[model samples]
Target: MMYIRTNQLLKAVILLLFAVFLFLLHETGEIARFINPQYVHLSQIASILFLFLFFIQVPRMFTNSEDDLCGCGLWGCSHGEEGRFAMKHVISYGLISLPLMIGFLFPFKDFGAAEALKRGVQYQVSQREARDEASLEKNVQELLEQSALVLHRDNFVSSLRALMAYPTRFVGKPILLEGFIIEDCQDEKVTVITRFLVTHCVADSHAAGFILEHEDSLGGREEQWLQVMGVLDVKQHGGVLLPVIRVIEWEEIEPPANPYVYP
Candidate 1:
């Protein structure tokens, strides 16, 4: 009886912890800090389910002593006379609760240029389909004809792709860009302007950016967000010729609300 009661208490606690985890994600509006913004509705649904389960477990703790809450005959409940909560059971639950405990202890952090460099930035963008190259080039030319080819959050990834795909077409064309600085090469004259390209979620996220070449060193600019108004210059870096920004005007800026750019 005592073992069953203890097991019920542990189960209730675990359910409540799960509920709180979901609640905090939504309450703090930090859900965007982890996953893509589009999937926030799914997180909302899961939080509701967890809260419902938590409430169900709360009443069960007082009404039933020997009843199995999980209802899985294979685990968590023992019906026999020798039934006892073993040390392994506690260890298993502890392991299950470890992630929740760690989340509470640490501040939520988003993956940035540091993680981008580790994954390696995509210097040259490629298209698998031939038609895409032509269409991308045409659209880029239209944009470049404007006063300045500005790259905004919605079309940032696509703009970079088009520019990288046809470097010569965009060479010397005035452009605008925003991203964090990442420097991996020995030379300090150039740095990568990187953004997290998240396809589905942060786990599948990777960094994408182009090289920025300037006469002055980008010292003390590491991991800082900046907006660059420049013209593309085809330059050689790491034996590959890619578009490098010849910066005309630049200034530091705050990181955007949604750091990850989606496809």
Candidate 2:
């Protein structure tokens, strides 16, 4: 009679599931939504490791009492009984499977204004302390030399930081930006165009963006995606100097497939 070890079988199954889950995330391009693309190769290596471990575990499932003994052939070195269930093992396995369950069951959604508010939206680069002023000035000079200043996911965080650090230098420079709107409660005509900056993964993501000023009312546009072409300007809000965009032309747009910016 062939007896399968329940514990070994469970481990094999979990390992296989983990491998599949990681592969699926990469295959569907959903991994970009979670981690920086540069570290994707690391995750791929992890999936391969899980698969190798699963294969190694497969043979252990069919081991009998004689096979369970260590190479020293001592009975005391035997692995625990095959069919025995332990609460500790169950709890450990459950904890391991929790992230897998959440990843597979829930769909990935872009962080909205409500989520940004919870994280405390950063409207200007000055909101953060401990900046390298010299480096920031150098970056701002390089950006100013460019004929056009466009903000995309790749340069979103850096450009905003430099521009906000030296708002006067960037003033009157035509710029383009895209992000979701976060309405300001204190000002009716002002709205924040916000993006989530992810240094490593979604867990550490935080809000960073520019405050936009429009001549017309910006009500009822909260949390909506927009593309704005404007000139950079400064505004004093809540007793802090902030870099603001004076809108020249703007339009509503659909949210991007991958909305998070990786720094």
Which candidate tops TM-score? 2
The residue-level lDDT of candidate 1 at 211 comes to 84
Please write out the lDDT profile of model 2 over residues 21-62, one tens digit for every residue.
999999999999989888899999999999999988877666
Look at candidate 2 and tell me the lDDT of residue 106: 86
**RMSD (CA, Å), each prediction:** 3.9, 3.3
- Candidate 1 on 94-203: residue-level lDDT in tens? 99899888888887677876787678778776546335767777767776777778888788877877777777777778888899998865343458788888877788
Clashing pairs in 1: none
Clashes per model (N, Cα, C within 3 A):
0, 0
Model 1, poorest ten-residue lDDT window?
A: 73-82
User: Which whole-number lDDT from 0 to 100 does residue 95 have in model 2?
Assistant: 100
What's the lDDT for all of these models?
0.75, 0.81
